[model samples]
Structure formats: C-alpha cells, structure tokens
Target: MTAHYTSQTDTDRAATETATAPAQRDRQARGIGSIDRLAGRRILVTGGAGFIGSNFARWLAPHAHVTILDDFRSGSRDNINDIDDISVIDGDIRDAGLVANAVRDQDVVVHMAAMAGVQRTLDNPVDTLEVNVEGTRTVLEAAVEASVDRVLFTSTSEMYGDLFEPPYREDGPIAPKTNYAVAKAVNERYVKSYCEAAGIPYTILRYFNVYGPNQDGSTDGYVVPKFVRRALADDSIPVYGSGEQTRDFTYIDDALDATIRSLGPAGRNETFNVGTGYECSIRRLAEFAADVVGRGHIIHTEDPRPYRVERRCADITKARGVLGYAPRTPLPDGIAKVAAAMKRSDRQRAREV
Candidate 1:
C-alpha cells in the first residue's frame, strides 16, 4: 500500500477542477449515469477510507466534491490514496469540534465511520459502543448545526439477528444479538430522531454482506474476502458450524447504486434494504470462492460466537419499487471479480516490494 500526501491547496484546486469537468461520457462508460444528479454537489463521507466507504467515495468523486473524515483506525490510507481531488480530514468522529468542522458547508453527509467486524466488536464492546453510537451522535449534531441537506446513515443487516426469518424487511423487527449490531441499531434510531427533531432530511440504508474489491481479507475481515485470500493461497477455507447459515451477499457496485439512489428525492427520509433478494449458504459461498480461484479445500470449524443467525436474506421490494434499485451482479460473477482484483493487487504489491 503506497502512500502520498498533498497540501490542502492542491486538494481543493483539484476538487474544483473535478467538479467543473463534464462527466457525462465517463459516467455513461462506468454505468453510473444515475448518480449524475449529484454532479457539482459537495459531499462528506465519514470513514471514506474503509472498504464500502472508499468504493462509494471513489464512485461519487467523479460526480461531486467529496470530503473524507477518518481516524485511520480500521480504515487504511491505501484504500483512498489513489483518489484524486478528495479532501481528507484525519480525525476521530467522536471529536465534536472536528466533526463540526468536517460537516460544515457539505451538501450531504454519508456517515460510514464505525468500529466494524463482529468478532472485533465482541472483544471491545465499550469502544464499539462509544465509536459507533456516540460518534454517530456527534456527526448528527454537527450535520444539524451545519444545516446539511441530508444525512445518510449506514446500518447493518446483522441487526436483524437470529429472531427474524429469511428475507428481512426494512419495517421488520430487529433483534440484535451482537454488540456491533446493537450499536448500529441504536445509531439508526439516533439518526431518525435527531434528523426529525432538527427538520433535516435523512436516509437510512441497512446493508447486507457487502463485499468486493478493496475489502479487507485479514484476520478480522468479512467471509468473502477471507475466503478469497485463502483460496488464492491454496489454503483451507473455514466454515463455521454446519455451514448452513445463509447471508444476502450484495456486491459493491450494486450496494453503491442503491446508496446513490438513496441520495435522490425518491429515497428521502426512508429506510431501505440494500441487497439482492437472494440467499446463499456459507458452505456454498466457500465452494464458489475456491472454484473461482481454482484452488483450496473446505474445512468445518466450531462456531465461536455464542449466538448466530441461521438464515438471512433481504426483501428488496421496497428499494426496487421506490428507488429503482436493481442489483445487476450475480454471486459467481462478483466472486470472479474479487479474485481477479486480488490477483492484480498481489502483482502490484510484488512490484512495490
């Protein structure tokens, strides 16, 4: 992961050029013409250096003036180093003064900075609560003070917990079993309450297992990337318990499309489930990952967590009807993309070394 730093003046100038540049041709080529509505808008993306956040920021950068606020805790500089003309604020979201400064003059705030990962949150529950809940509160307060046009809060489908059946809906009851889910669930309520009281429009997006390029495949990363990493190495892919636990694995592009649509008027002040209405078992996913990479074998392991959701899928009827949110990528195709991206990244790293 290479790192590059530029002065604020340079960043601001580049941003101005990017905002003023015509992007219709490029947008059409990238298939992101839907987000052209955001052209010339000023947007702030907290945790814009993380996986989903960084991808969203990169997609939005070509169309809008983007500012990223991250403390570099879980987010890496490598994830965002190549993005041109992005203003980055290196600070904690819990810092009220810093958050206020970041939020000022931004047309929209996409709050994505939070302590993520199920195991990590379980190990450090207090820090997770403070960062995810309190940090969100600080961002909301700042957004209200700055009079931003909208606040988009990113929530997790894990909040649905084991109590819910498959095909979870936005209006369905949430029974969060993990501390990470609890923090996100609480933040969702905070976003709604704070935005309503302040008369600020808000959009809540509950994302399922979002995965693709730029995702972490380290010891504490998501299942898809982790599986890909091991498969590439011809190592055994671990499956917890009976491997029957299912998840709605939404690819990054589809997730981004849903997110961009949420910023428009059609998605105003509403919660939407951002996922493909399909369920894939963990065992099947592991097999697909190995097959995509052309290597590796599957191995079963004891479920470490005290509780686990057996099946989870999204009911995207609302998102589809309201925002025209349609997921175009299939699981096999998405996994192939991830494998290809990892190979390219490996080649780049080898050259760097």
Candidate 2:
C-alpha cells in the first residue's frame, strides 16, 4: 500500500477547485477517465470514522476533498486523526440540521451511518430501527436539498435473511429477519424513491460479510474480529449452534475497491451485490482464524444470537460486469493479515504494560 502524503498546498488547491462551478466540474468528470473521476471532488461520508467508513475515507482523501460527518457513537476520532487533508465534523445523522450543513457544497455523499450489528439489534430492536431508518432519511433529505451529483447508500446482505439460497443475486427474495436488516431494506426503498423523484443519481450496494483491521470484535460484536482476538489470546473460539452457518466474507480492500468504482458513472441508479462468490462455514471460519493465529481451541454451543443466517454467497456477476470488481484476497491470506495485526497490537500493549 503506497502512502498518500497531502500537504497544505494541495489542500488549498483542492478547496479552490471545489469552490468553482459545479457544472464545469461535472463536465470534466464525465469526460475524464474512470480512474480520475474522483479527483478533487468534495465528498461527504456519513459515519466516516467507523471501521469501513474510515478505510474508505482514507483511501479517497488523496484524490478527493473528504469531509466526515460522524456522531462519534460507534466511531472514534482516532480513526481519522492521522490522515491529512480530511475534515471531521462531530454530529449525528439524525440531526437534520447537522446533516444538511455537512451536505452543503459537496459533489457526492456516501451514507454509511446506521445502527449496525445483529446481536446489538436483537438487544434493542426499536432503537436500532429508529436510528438507522431515521438517520438514513435525514441523509437523503439533505442530499436532495444540496442536489449532490451522486449518492451511495450501503446496504447489507443480511437483508436476504437466511434464505438457504447459494450465491444470492441482486434481485433475490427479501426476507429481513433482524431489525438491522429491516432498517437497511427500508432505507434502500427510501433511497430509490427519493432519488427517482428528486432526479438525483444513486447507487445501492449490498455488502456481504466484511472483515478486516479496525473491526473491534470486543465492542463491535463482529464474528471474525471476536474469533481472531480470542484465538490470539489462546482462548477457546466460541461457535454458535452446530457451527454450520455460512457467509461470504469480502475482505475490506476488495470491498473498498468496489465502493470507489461505484462512485463513477457506471453505477448510477443501480443495485449490486458486492462480495466474493465463495461460502465458508462458521466452523471453518473459526478453524482458519485459529490456524492463522498459531494456537487456539474451538468450542461449540447453542446459538446465542437471534435470527442467524444459515447460508450466504453473493453472485457478483453484476459487480464484475458493471463496476469491474474482482475480489483478490483469499480467505487464508486475509485471515493471516488479521492475525498479524492482532499480534502487533498485542505486542504493543504488552510493551505499554
């Protein structure tokens, strides 16, 4: 990964270009190559300090003027503090005033702020729905008001809801079992309606199981991070149910690549499933994590979470054809990187102690 070093001069130039006529900028973008489509555009990323959001913001900051609007609820300031040439706003998405202000003069908006996590939703279904649904509406309204060039909404494959189908397609049956999935489904509909009525270009991406560094297993309640952390500690890796549940895990880099590609003209007003068309059972996933971490044990138990998905795999033909997305990292390779990161963190903590 080549580091992107931004200076004050570049920041000043980007700001000047952003303040120029939006019409001219749009024309240039339309005429330019896809690789340079994002250059110097002002972009607002909701929940920009969270796990995937932070990574996307960092990756785009060098090419675009990135402004992050986050409530700091599940996101932390530390995520974006080291990245240069990025603006950070501390506010919630539900606050219409804050969202509107953040949307001002931005060429694009990427809405990722929502109440996520299945177990967390099961614990507080009402709150999850209220926050995720209401927050998305707020962002959509603000985008309409600002008349941003494009808006990207992140949905989840969990919206498919344990359909026992292999390689779920973009037009599969809707069976959202959890409040989190329900909220995402509702938000997807809302985005379509608003974008169609208001004449705003939009793209909806249903991300499959996403895992990488920055995912906090302890607090974020994600399976990969939790299992990896436990494995690194030489603790028993817990498996819910018979450990037969399966998911299509897309590494963060591949996910981010698809996201950036979708920002161009090719993805407008389209819904695509972004994932590797591969399935790994929970038992296998845990075993891989343990193997990567060098030493650990697996323990099976009754399912603790409500409404688990038994099988999941995405048919990425659309993503491949439309966005030119190709997932590169294999499961073991990704797991090895995660384990290496955990080991580094562990060593750092020990030294601090």
Candidate 3:
C-alpha cells in the first residue's frame, strides 16, 4: 500500500506557536493544559479521515507525529488533504496486517473508526456489527501487541438509550436501543477487557451529539449538519416525532479538547461523558438552525424508527472534576458557526465550478 507523508516547516511551527501562545497560557493557568502532554509522541489515529477523527488529527499534527489509517469507506480524502505534516495510510482497521503495521512504534492509538449513523446501522445491521465490533477488536489487539502507552476509544451516548432520566452519568446503566449503539457498547466492553488483561492504559469517551464544521450534511448525517444544510438551501427543516426529543449538542472544539485532556494521567482507565450539561429539544434545534441561516421553515415529520431516545443530556460533572473539561459554546452560537461554515463551503464550491 502506498502512504502519503508531509512535514511542517520551521516557519509554520513558529507561526502556530505564536498564534496559540495566549490560549496555551490560559489553559495552563486553568490547569487544563494536560493536552500538552501529548507533544512529541507518535500517535496513530484510526479512521482519521472521518469528521471527528480528521479534526482531531489535524489539530494534533503540529504538536505530534500523527499517522492516519482509514479505508475511505465513509471518510473523505478532502478532510485530511489540507494538513501537511501527518502521514496517511489508506487501509481498513479490520485488516490485521494493516492495523499491526499502523500500530507499530506508536506511543498512542486513538481509535475513532466505526460504522456510524442510526439509520445507516439499522439498514445494515450485520455489516455494522462486524465492522464496529470486529474492527475495534483488531485495533485493540494490535495496540496491545505494539505495547502502546495508551489507547483512547471513542464511544457514543446513544448507548444510554431512553431507559433512564436525562443528564446521564458515567456510572449509570446503559440501555442501548439501536444497532450502532449496541456495537459501540460491546466495543466498550472489549476495550475494557482487552486493555485490563494486557495491563494497558485505556480511556473510553462517550460523546453526545458532536457537531460543527466539516460534519456530514447528507441525509444520513447528524441533526445539526442536516438541519444547517436544509436551512442554507431554504428548504423546510424536518422535526421528527413531536420534536420534543432532547439532546445535548456539544460543539466539535469542546469534544476535541476533552479527548486531548483524556490522554493525560487523570483519564487513565476511565470512562467520561463528553458533553455540555444543557439539553435542547429537537424543535428548538430546528428553530435555532432556521434563525441562524435566516431562512427555512420548520415542518413536523413522522419518525419511523421504533426505538428512539426521548432525552439525552450528559452530566459532565465527572468530566469537569476529572479532566477539567468545560464546554464554552452554547447551542445557538454553535449553530451559527455551522451555518457560516456551510455558506463558506457553498461559495468555495461555486467559485470552483
């Protein structure tokens, strides 16, 4: 397999350091600069071409040596094309030889690869299970054999389902209602067992509705991006069921910061809920998107899914106390940012055409 490698110049490094000096100082003052601990490490990010994974890899490229292993099934090359310092390995995580090669000599492995989307998983249950469960097993086993310092696995809050109340805590019970959630929950168990048996350090991050720029806005995409896309096009925004179902919409930056902090000492062998503690109903989310774009009208649509979670709000108290995780962006602000980004992307595409 052919691999693409890029390197950052001294001038680029200097410029980045100068621009981020103030923010770095602020983080240090707040005792949350644990993310600085990852500097100079060799890190392998599985699925590094996807939305969250690509963003994380891009942000960390200047600070560390980053390698991305992705099959490009659900990931796009455009996501990582702009970054000039990361190494890209085009392959699948399920390929043991490929995974072993990627994991070798890496100090950290951030496993964010998985078959995502609720409707997509429902439509292809068997493929979802095998890719998520088996792919995760392959990555974790490779990490163990490679003797990587730490392995961080990204999970979803959907595993909590609708059984319990809102503001789900980390230690609470998980009642996964979807095929994708079931696979993620099972992968969590596998990560715990495999890491523990091999005496490896691991961290499991259960992310809520993480959305921002670079997010997929297709039909099978997340709510925020989909709503933004429709609003930008002046199309009617769809609200499922009574639109009363609530979710904790965490911004992309906040989620990335939390994940970075988890690589520090406080997050070893721990599970943390990465989300804002606030909840916003689906109706309100649609309204926010419309208001942000200054277009589109809200329209109620029937949700055909049999299993749906009525409420999802993460109790991020554990994350705060443990990782000093503080989410700064509110829902409206985040929606505005997404709208602005989509408009910019539209303009870019128009110019290209």
Candidate 4:
C-alpha cells in the first residue's frame, strides 16, 4: 500500500476547518497525522448510536459537527455517550419528514440505520423491507432533496447471498437468500437509481462481517458475538454446520477508516467492498475467539444458520485502487480487540456491585 501521507498545507487547512467547526476540528485534532479529511466536517450517521455508527461517531466527534439518528430499533444510547457534543435524533428511518429534517444542514450523510439482522428479518419480513428498502429510499431521496454533498450507502455483503463465488466483487449479481439480504439489495437499487436520476453522488459500501466493541444481541446467529457471549459465560461455543462455512470479518475501526475516506475525493456513483480479503470459517473463528479469551471447551452443534450454504469474502482491488484503502487490522488482532472489550464490559458490570 502507498504510504498514507498529507502535506503541511493539508494539516493547516484541516486545523483551520476544525477551529471554525468545533466537532469537525476535534476529529482532525484527534487523528492529527491520520485520517485528516474526515475531521472537522458536518456528518450525519443514521443509526449513529449503533455498533458501527457509534464507533464512527466516536472516531469523528469533537473534530466534526456530528449528528446521529437512531430509532432505537437495534441501537443503544450508551454506545455514543463518549461523544457528548454530537446531535442525537431519536427517530425512525422510515419517517420521511423526520429523516428530511435530519438530512437538512449536513455535509455528508452516512446512512447506517435499517431493519437489521437475519433473525429479525425472518421474524418480521415486512418491517425489514420497510426499513432496509424503503428507509434507504427515504434517505437517498432526502439527500437529493437536501442537496447534500455526498452520501455513503452502507450496503451489505448479504446482498450477494449464497453466491458460490469467492471474494465477491461489487458487480457480482445473485439472489439474496434471506429477507434481510433481499431488502438490502432493494435498498441498493433505490440508492443507485436516486444517484443516477437526481445527479446525487454516493458510495455503496458492501461491508463484510464487521465485528468489534459494543456489538450486542442485535444480530442473532452472528458468529462473533454469539461465540463471544458463550465464551464469556464459560459455555461451549456453538458450531453450525461442519464448521467450514467462511466469512471475511473486518474490524470496526478499519471499516470506519474506509468510511471516512469515502466522504472526500473517492469515486462517486460507485460501489466497493469493505472487507479484509482473508476468510475464516465460523467454527475456526469461534475457536480463535475462545483462545483469545483464554476459554474453550466448545461443543459442536448442527448448522442452525438460517441462510442457505455458501462461502463469502471480498475482492478489495477497487477499494485499494480508487479509495487508497485496505483492511489494515488483521483478523486475529481484531477478534482479540473485541475479546478485550468484552472483558472490560464484564469488569465494568462487576464494579456496579
């Protein structure tokens, strides 16, 4: 990878931008020599209090004018409390008036909110489509209305559900096996059409399995959290299938890095996969997490995963070439980081005694 670098002029401009906008300045100041472009900008992260959104908000706040919109469907306020200065709006993505209100007066719209997770979709498919498909449409349409500078559409790798292809590219077309994936695919369609129709620029980031701190019980049958919770309880980790199904797990920090980069000079009306090209089976990943936590004794279970059988990863060549981005954090290290955070959360709970 090319050495990430910016000039003194870049730093000075970044500093000036931050000084004028307190939130915008702080993120740049926090990063200093790193991730400067995202600093000191007006950013709205829908579902900003959720796992990925919260992490990005924390990373950007105090450096940029940050606004978070979360309807509390799958997000919690505690995830973003560390970034106190951000504007938090408690509203649903489907609320066009509410979302339009949020979209007004924003530099960039990072749309992360949606009816999420496989189990939740299976339980309520209509609600899932409403948020994922209609919600995305609402946001993009509002962005077109508001004339926002840029929008980042958080598409899902699940959009390519059950593709027998390894390292799935953004153009890989296939059917989404579950309601969740289907909704996400629909969301992608609407966003793409809005950008094309209204001359709106956007980045459709097809994220792989993103795991890190503050990821909770939202996504049931999610390998990382499920295994982590079981390990924390000193219980045997559950292995679905023969433990051979694989995923490209990208850390939250790296995802945030790539996301922030997309806000600026990257290609427009484009789609890229945000993932580490490496793949690990659910069973092996669980075993690794167990080892990281100094726990194990996992008993094998049948594949209870709702989706049909398929292996998945990402071909990040486009992201590298266009965005100058790569998954920096390795799999083992990211898992261990989340494992440490899990221990920290446990310790904090114990302290309440």
List lDDT for all candidates, in order. 0.86, 0.82, 0.86, 0.75
The residue pairs that clash in candidate 1, if any, are: none
Across 1-353, the per-residue lDDT of candidate 2 in tens digits comes to 11112222334434433443652343233313553788999999999999889988877876889999998888888788888999999998988998899999999999998877766678887889888999899999999999999999999998887754677889878888878888999999999999999999999999998998768789347888889889878999989888887888888878887888888889999999988998888888888877666678999988766456778889899999988888876776666656656666778899999
TM-score of 4: 0.87
User: Candidate 1 at 90: error in angstroms?
Assistant: 0.2
Q: Residues 51-152, candidate 3, lDDT per residue (tens digit)?
A: 999988877887889999999999999999998799999998899999999999999999999988878888999999999999999999999999899999
RMSD of each: 9.2, 9.9, 8.4, 8.1
lDDT of 1 by residue, 111-190 (tens): 99999987888889899999999999999999999989999999999889878577888888999888899999999999
Model 4: CA > 4 A from native? 1-35, 217-221
What C-alpha lDDT does candidate 1 achieve relative to the native structure?
0.86
**Which is better, 1 or 4, measured by TM-score?**
1
TM-score of 3: 0.91
lDDT of 4 by residue, 73-191 (tens): 77887887778789999998889999999999898898999877767778898888788888888888889998887788898888777655777777777667888887778877888
lDDT of 4 at 315: 83
At residue 335, candidate 1 shows an lDDT of 73
Query: lDDT rank, highest first?
Result: 3, 1, 2, 4
